[model samples]
Target: MARASATPRSSAYLSALSQEIEKKLQRALASPPQRRNLLQELFADVALEVDDRARDIILSREEDTISPADDSHLGQLCFYDVLADYYVQAPESGKPILDLIVQLWSQSFASHIFSLLFHKWLFEVQLDNPEVLLRYSSALAQGATNVFWIDIQTNTRRFQSLFCYLLDEVAVEPARLNKIPVQAQRDLYLLLSRFILFYNSGDKLDTFLKHCPTFPNAFLIGGPTDFFVTELADQLQKLKVEPVLLHYLSNLKVLQGMELRMATSTRLKTCLYSFTSPGGPMYPTRAVRHAAWDALDLLFPLFDWRSRTLHPVYSAHLQRRSTA
Candidate 1:
């Protein structure tokens, strides 16, 4: 994705911000005992929501002055967001920070900072060294997974833009997706599958499934749709948040007519059914139970036939639930 060049004023402010980050990283590198603390603090600083004062300076315009309070499109902007762009514009400016990150790679928040700031750079630049490329790709996947889970656990869209960029820019773009190794590509796709619905990217479902990477275990897991549904079903089983679960259930309508393996279909069916029941196992709330029923009805309208075709005891259970 092409980003507009920052204005001279914003560029200078971003340069200062970059220097502050680098100084902290350098301190971390110089003091082994303080490395983790310093890196953690740096990560927190970059992740902070851009305040009004910082916003005005970092996003200043040539013609009109930007209002600190005018947070129409900049509400979600963070220091990392500005710095990420800064690094993209001046790749050299980020080399020092990147080197510091590599030295402190084992510490907490190191990968998080790298992923947030250099996600675009990782894909945009060409790395000739295979080992280095693999390491960076692995780090990107690991870091992205960590941040995405934060969004999931809090049921917040704080990282929605990040997810969108990975999906829209990296996942779908062949050239960009191919930049990473096969293993990393597979990992990236799997990671995206689990959170796609959470981030409300169901509209891109068709495109996403179409470009899914070829997994070595395709025979075991079936095709792209099957793998995606399997991941999604597993995600459903893990979701404790009612709103996020319901959001997922509601989005299952998109899977209506896709052909899936019988086992894969059963896996999804069993997952949704777990929530439909009132007790034990899933023990879903009333709202979730109803939503699951809706999803089941939409995905498997003919599932009722299974009650009659199966054992009498199971048939009675289904009969009672239908009336209940």
Candidate 2:
């Protein structure tokens, strides 16, 4: 009877302990040493249970139902609240702590780490707020772009699958894009566009782009030689986002080189030169041309395609290769 009573008492004690720790975490996360050190203390005190409880708190919602705001709070609090400022104030001391959290949490609870970082990136920088986006894009554009790349680099398959899962969740049925808010739709569009534009140089980025759903391989590979550009062109036609589509394709052409095989289509070839064939060329407006050239110039130095021809540099090279 005494032992039975002790068991309930122990249960109650642990429950109280958990509540105390949670309350402390909420408060502690708001400040400095507490912001960083409290996490360490929690790890020491609660050990692996920290992962379980934190994961449960974070993953409480169905993945599809979770919003950027939901996933962003902790990361925003940690970075924008005081910790990042602390890092700025004392890089030598604070950098290690911030780095440790990013490293250890990533290793231990990758999904949670990814959720925090990805949504933080979206909510902080990738939102439809023009002022915020422009400021962030100017201040730390590379860092903003690196957020997605770093997550993918951390664990290729996991992050890729996670991204696809998130995409599926946001892609509501029937109404499709109309299901997401107009702002959210624009933000999502920017996210995709930035992925194409910013990370256009690396091999992993190339492989990622080639395989991503927007350029799915099954539809791309094993088709006719002339069909490569057409496949993407047709897909873009269906989506009807002509400006974004043309600009993205131009970035891919510059980055991927002959890999895109845009010259394979004779009609596409002519349109590439004229840049004014409204009836046939997808890039009908000057705005679309400028956007494409902007992406190209950003990635490639002195990339004045007007003074020179892309066909001489890229298309001619592509023509020599055997289609088989």
Candidate 3:
């Protein structure tokens, strides 16, 4: 059986489906059912297809993706390609998506682990093919590390949700449960932590701070305003990942969709940025980031359901910053 593999041709199919999904997402969100039945169905369809029979699947959810069928009903929606197009067509559709993302974040840590699992799968698949993997890895990071606010305006939900859910979930849980190799986990964590900043979870931050050994994955740690970079810095030091943080002294643009130059600082253009070691992870340079970001943007709301557990982000500028 030829499952959906990551080929240009198969991508063409997903690319088309994504467009329709974007259009439908608007209708679905504006008039969402009071119950979660229909949206949940879409989630199930995408999840099953991606998991059960996706061979040419350009991208899969993280290793620890949560299925809706999980014992606790804590399913994960980590496929950004499924939701990116929805974001492109209907930026306003993000409300429900955001609700779903927060729900995943707040409700089930196990479901979120799927994100990690998917990461392991993607990177591991690339290990034998060094040339292709490096580029794909970057695209994965850009979309994976994407924040919800960016998705509200652009089409990066599928990738963003997977990264955020995995990083946060892993950080919050006991490290003993992770069977993934240390080097691989550090590499993925570095990319995942870059644009992700979780608030109101005091000890969770503490836990992430504790596990970073040599600090190879510092790219994942950052200090965003409205929250506080210094606090993030302090936490990074406590967790022994300060070396990695220091390596990431300057922020690169990680958000893929932006005006380049917004009207004001408030509208500064942004792009997703990720680090790549030469001769390193999947899609080492361009392919991963480009393909994944494009696909994630292509699918948006449907694939990238926003978190239900997370509340609104109030933008209060402390000092100006940019991901560009």
Which candidate comes out best when scored by lDDT? Answer: 1
Model 3 — which ten-residue stretch has the worst lDDT?
A: 264-273
lDDT of every predicted structure (CA atoms): 0.82, 0.36, 0.34
Per-model TM-score on C-alpha atoms = 0.89, 0.28, 0.29
**Lowest summed lDDT window (length 10), candidate 2:** 1-10
Clashing pairs in 2: none
Candidate 1 vs 2: which has more lDDT: 1
| Model 1, C-alpha of 198: deviation from truth (Å) | 0.9
Report the candidate with higher TM-score, 2 versus 3.
3
What are the RMSD figures for all models against the true structure?
3.4, 17.7, 21.6
Residue pairs clashing in model 1 are none
Name the regions of candidate 2 deviating beyond 4 angstroms. 1-27, 34-147, 172-180, 192-310, 315-324
- Ordered by lDDT, highest first, the candidates read 1, 2, 3
Q: Give the TM-score of candidate 3.
A: 0.29
* Candidate 3, 61-106: lDDT as tens digits: 3455422222111233334433332233333443344334333332
